[model samples]
Target: MLNIVLFGPPGAGKGTQSQKLIARYNLVHLSTGDLLRAQIAQGTELGLRAKKLMDEGLLVPDEVVIGMINSALNDNKQAAGFIFDGFPRTVPQAESLDALLAQHDTKVSCMVALEVAEEELVTRLLERGKTSGRPDDQNEEKIRKRVTVYNTETAQVAGYYAQQQKFHALNGIGAIDSIFAQICGIIDQHQPATSESSRQATDEVKA
Candidate 1:
């Protein structure tokens, strides 16, 4: 399986790029944020728990989120792979994920970090607040806090993957298509040559 983790702070266009990658690669989009929101929307026990934390802009407890991911992976073992967004936010979560995938005889093949300027994130959040009316985005104080939390907590996972030579940084600025191309280029460079289909997919995008 072509396991991929998409890492970025809030408002960095992770979702937008993920959707494009999923469609092009036939990968499952396992966005933790969406999974939790769906659970909340459905009033599932897990969703209700996550909702309380999310409404306060707090990180959901690692175990609860990891449980959700494990269940998803178990149920979707037949999938081509997964694009994990908004997940593995802490070192422990990342470690747990590695173990889970290892049990399946697969591992995270790539960890793509979307490198966006803090000012860009702030600007994007403010714009999102205007259009989406999301309470978290509206408060500059809260936005700053979230960004700080992301840097302090989630950013370290990049180093963990870097040590394994599985981390790649992609510029999060530029036209959406251009940014996607850049990401595809990184993946293409790393995917094994024996994987002809993945190579073709990347080439098609580059073309």
Candidate 2:
């Protein structure tokens, strides 16, 4: 499976790019934020807990996030691959993800990080807040705090992947298509030859 870890700070356009990548690569979208929200919507015990943390702009516990990802992986056994968004934020979480994927005999194909300036992120998020109805987005202080947390606590995860030569960073300030093309180039380089053949066969069958 061609699993990818999509890395970026908030307002880096990960959600938009993930949709495009999913369409192009037939990857399942495993967004931790979405998963947490689903639990919240269901009013589960975990949801209640996660909601409290999230309302305060705090991250949910790693174990809870990993469990949700494990369930997603199990549910999508036939997926072409999975694009992980808003996950594996800390180095330990990255380690856990590596172990989890190992149990499935597949590893992260690559980690693609989007590089955006903090000011740009703040502006974009504030604009999104006008329509997104997300309190975190509307509050500039919360947005900056989140970015700082990522930098101080989560940025090291990139080094973990880089040591394995499976990390790619792209400029996130350009046109959406331009940035996507850069990401696709990196993915094409890492994609296994067998996966190409399998995709072709699947396409042929569809045709």
Candidate 3:
């Protein structure tokens, strides 16, 4: 399976690219925000706990988030792969993710970092604020805080993956198609080859 981690600051088109990758590669898309919302909507115990933190405008605790991810992985194990978005925003979470995947006898195939100019991100975010009515986008102070927090917390996670030789950096400042093409290129180069012969061999063993 071609597990991929999409890493970048807010407004870097991480969600957009993840959607595209999911469609093209038949990957299970796991966005932490989506997971939390689904859990809260289902009114699960973890959901209720996370909701309290979110209601208080605090980040969800790592254990809660990682537990949610583990459940998602189990549910989606039949998928050909997974594209992770908006989780692992800290080194500890990244390390935990490594441990989780290791237990499944798989690991992250790649971590793609979206590189964009700060001014461009800020400008795009300001425009999105008016259009999307997202509170985090509406205030410059909050937007800056979000970006700063991303840098301080998540940026170092890239180094962690880099040491594992699974890091790939791509320019985020480009036409959407161009950026996507670059990402697809990386995917093509790294995905494992699982030919029909291999499939038949595995099936024979199961039989």
User: What range of 10 consecutive residues in model 1 has the weakest lDDT sum?
Assistant: 186-195
1-207 per-residue lDDT for model 1 (tens digits): 788899999998999999998987788999998888788889998888887777677899888888888889889889988899988898999999999899888889898988899999999999999987567889888888889999998899999999999999888888998888888887665566426786777777777
Count of residue pairs whose backbone atoms collide, per candidate: 0, 0, 0
- What value does the lDDT take at residue 125 in candidate 1? 91
Off by over 4 Å in 1: 193-198
List the lowest-lDDT window of 10 residues for candidate 2.
Answer: 198-207
The predictions' CA RMSDs to the true structure, in order, are 1.7, 3.8, 6.7
Prediction 3 global C-alpha lDDT? 0.81
Question: How high is each candidate's TM-score?
Answer: 0.93, 0.92, 0.84
The C-alpha lDDT values of all candidates are 0.86, 0.88, 0.81
Q: Output the better candidate (1/2) by lDDT.
A: 2
What lDDT score goes with residue 199 in model 1?
A: 72
Task: Name the better of 1 and 3 by TM-score.
Answer: 1
- Relative to the unseen true structure, what is the C-alpha lDDT of residue 80 in candidate 3, on a scale of 0 to 100? 88
